[model samples]
Target: MSTIASLSRSWSSRVPAKRRDPRCAEPIDVREKRYGYFPKMFVHRGHRYEVYAVERCWTVSRRGRRDRIERHCFRVRCLEGTFELYQDVRHNTWHLQRQVD
Candidate 1:
């Protein structure tokens, strides 16, 4: 094997992999800011998480329909860890998208 390839493999092996669940669509209850609709806290599976900071926020539009928003996604940081949460615009319900820890 090439020297660079071996070094890259070694580096990757030493770093811990991030666990992610892309299909975690479980429903959640979220409390958001009154005006801008930013998530401040959420409850999932009987556990409550208070969002300390919003890392990222974006809207997912429907395929072939740019004007229509399907969901509002937020990557937030809480006391336990970072998590991806989203709100389904059509149903007006919240969901825990994934855990990034």
Candidate 2:
């Protein structure tokens, strides 16, 4: 059987354009340290990455509705590299925004 890592690599390579484009944010699975606050780890494109440190974090409010949050953004560092991840509060879904470095 092919390993998950290998499968992820193959799948990612098949769609290089989408994977590389910052504009195309993809869905991801995230595990938060706190109940719903800080991200501890995340999986993107079938690859798991542990968050080493959170460089920055912020929340965006829905337009014309400051009381409602739109999404929560986090810039995090992992063993492989740095990434920007975000959680859509309204939908309660996570996405891999971009690879910072």
Candidate 3:
């Protein structure tokens, strides 16, 4: 092997692989603001629910299906007040309707 190649291999083997820091994985401020807090409600089946914001959502689709599904973590202001809640997976948009409360 060449001098350069041998040197590179020696150095690479000496270095330890970097690991993800648990603290860096999550920010303290965000944990303080949102962790352990979620909205509680019984939604009617056909009423409009006002959405203030969304925190996270995932789009999923099955094989051979033409349509995609979207799930949302939404925060909304309701008659009771504003709260964060997990919304069901609908089509492209979040469904608004009366939920049995």
Candidate 4:
């Protein structure tokens, strides 16, 4: 999230971008904490990351060719490291955006 985006007064006004990671859509198994909204485990690139903690989460949207695209992004900590994962709510897809550590 950009500084200005992070400072949004309300969740409805927040603007979100995919940060520095290259965009790729890959299928993964996710263990959900609640209604599959919160991630408890993440698997990608043949490596399974157990999400020990979810630091933060939010949703952002952008205009798409077909419809308004919404993404659910989670900043989480796992056995390996901290990472940002964003899920496309409209398409039911997930992207591994970047690693914080």
Give the best candidate by lDDT: 2
lDDT of each: 0.81, 0.82, 0.38, 0.76
Residues 19-81 of candidate 1 have per-residue lDDT tens digits of 233454789988555356888878888898889899999998776454565899989999999
Off by over 4 Å in 1: 1-23, 32-36, 64-69
Per-residue lDDT, model 4, residue 26, is 51
**lDDT tens string, model 2, 7-99?**
988978886575467468889998556555889988887888998789999987766445665889999999999988888888888888878
Deviation in Å, model 1, residue 73 alpha carbon: 0.3
Looking at model 1, residue 23 earns an lDDT score of 57
Q: What does candidate 3's lDDT look like per residue over 7-83, in tens digits?
A: 99998777544212211111111111223443233333333344343333343344436565444444445554554
Model 4 C-alpha lDDT per residue in residues 1-101, reported as the tens digit of each score: 78777676455444344352246445666755555478887778888888878899998888879889898888999888998888888878777877778
Better of 1 and 3 by lDDT: 1
- Which portions of model 4 show Cα errors greater than 4 Å? 1-27, 31-35
TM-score of 2: 0.68
Measured over all alpha carbons after superposition, the RMSD of each candidate to the real structure, in angstroms, is: 5.1, 12.2, 15.8, 7.5
Given candidate 1, what's the lDDT at residue 95?
A: 86
User: In model 3, what are the clashing residue pairs, if there are any?
Assistant: 43-99, 44-98, 44-99, 45-98, 45-99, 46-98, 47-97, 47-98
